[model samples]
Target: MREFLIFSRTARTGGKINPKNLFQEGRLDIIRDFIVEAFFTANKKRSAIVHCFLYGQPNPPLHLTITSSAPVSIDRVKTATLLSDLISKKKKIRGCEMKKESIIEFLTKASKTKTIYLLDKKGKSIHETKILPNAIFCFADHLGFPRKEFKRISTISAETISLGKQTYFAYQALMLLQYFLDEKGID
Candidate 1:
């Protein structure tokens, strides 16, 4: 199964943030489209795991993992509600809270079997990169990864990938990646 790990630097972890205002808040704005498209792009089952680092919080970041083929809601507003319930309460809302983990912890745990790829223009062309059967894709928010976060990710030896020379928006990049994967019969 294809898994997408998105890192939102400004997304709020309060679970109270309005989904409709996700774009206005400059937090989940760019990722909203990606989350919506990632699941629907493929006929096969796919998964999207968003790791949100709130603007200054002592607690852990919010991790939302949703299966594309599952019978759960995936709309923006419904997704917002699910996120709110997932982060605010311990109980699962319509099977939302299956896992709550940190990025570091998740990276270490998933590193064994899954090949992690970081999206960056300076990396190799995705068309030529040999993709593994079990792969996890990572992307930073529009604001981009800060120096510290980038350094940490670098230590993981995550291969950098680029769609082309031009820089595209987060959602556009996702679509391009999916399209490339589909062309390679990887989706």
Candidate 2:
């Protein structure tokens, strides 16, 4: 299955989220949008999974794993509600699982099986790279990955790839990447 790992430097690790104030509460709105993009298409859902690593105040390194296998329908509101419940209750809900894993730990295990690609502006063009069917695209929030962490990520053998010269939001990048894969019939 297609997988995505989003590193959010400012997303909250716990506590209830103010749906209306997602931007103030560590930009949870972006995380919500990412989940929506990962599963929804025009009228159907895609077969994919998205892992969100939140490193924000009060707590750090909160991992949210959202899979397309969720029984309930997903949207911006539902996604935000699910997140709030997951954070406040600290329990697994349907297709979404919560954990306290770091990015390094997650990548170390994922790299062993799935082809890992780090999305960066300075990397090689994605068009030239051979993306595997079980590829996992790794990216960061608007602030980007931490310098020390980025260095560590490179050492994990993740192939760096560039969507283009221009920068795109994490959700936008996922959409483009999904389209490209669909065109190539990768999954």
Candidate 3:
């Protein structure tokens, strides 16, 4: 299955989410948008999973795993609501599962089984690279990952790939990546 791990530098760890103030509250709106893009199409959901690594106030290193296989409807509002319930309850809520896990830890473990690709503008073009099955694309939120985290990730053996020179939002990158994968019949 296609997997995406998004690192949100300013997304809240765990707490009540104000749907109207999602942008102000650690840019949860971006996370919601990413989830919507990852799982939803015009008429149905895609077979994919999203891992959100939230490092913001109240708590740090909150991991929210959203799977399309779960029996729940997904949309921008529903995604935010699910995040709110998962954060407050700190447990599995329908399609979402919440936990406290660091990005490094998750990558280190995933690298053993899945092909990890780091999405960066400066990296090699995605067209040149061979994307294997069960590929896990790693990317950052609007604020982007810190330099120190890059150093930590560099040691994990993940190949960096670029969509193009033009910068795109995380959700846009995900959509483009999915399209490319679909065209190539990777998934």
Candidate 4:
């Protein structure tokens, strides 16, 4: 996932904007020119991830999982709830917290190395959270080692195509995602 500059057009199965129609009607070409001009103007790189989303759907192929409508506290609650749901669905998690000794034992049994990424919302270290020292000591004492391979990232950028404005913001967000997940030595 090298850095990219994606030029995406929405899918057109129904009432959504169709890439074929846009290209045939010459709007996509105009957009392509605009994007190229903007990229040159900003002296930015050309790596991008062009995507098409279906309209009127709860889930898109590529989606922005974060929302601004919820308050901060509610957002955190929602995040925790979603993660809890995932763990429950997997049937692998026993309780709210997996014991650190169990986690270390599992890691020790695995033949292949695993990369555990500890990401906080806004790319802060979970260690940077309150009770950091206590939490670190607890885990260190349990595992006899630290899981510190996780990297911290700041923000994501993206652009949306709407209201006659090119979705440059969504593009930037995609770039940021690529930067975070691509070729950072996960193995």
Q: Which candidate gets the maximum lDDT versus the true structure? A: 2
Greater lDDT among 1 and 3 belongs to 3
Task: Give the runs in model 3 whose Cα sits over 4 Å from its true position.
Answer: 71-74
Candidate order (TM-score):
2, 3, 1, 4
RMSD in angstroms, candidate 4? Answer: 19.7
Per-residue C-alpha lDDT of model 4 across residues 92-161, encoded as one tens digit per residue: 3222222212222332332133222222233333233322110101111111112231111011111111
Question: Each candidate's lDDT (Cα)?
Answer: 0.65, 0.84, 0.84, 0.24
lDDT for model 1, on a 0 to 1 scale? 0.65
Predicted model with the maximum TM-score: 2
Give the clashing pairs for model 1: none
lDDT of 3 by residue, 113-147 (tens): 98889898998899999888877898899888899
State the lDDT at 139 in candidate 3: 82
Candidate 1 runs further than 4 Å off = 24-26, 42-58, 69-74, 98-100
The alpha-carbon lDDT assigned to residue 100 of candidate 3 equals 89
Lowest lDDT block of 10, candidate 4: 133-142
The predictions' CA RMSDs to the true structure, in order, are 3.0, 1.4, 1.5, 19.7
- Each candidate: how many clashes? 0, 0, 0, 18
Q: How close is candidate 4 to the true structure, as a TM-score?
A: 0.21
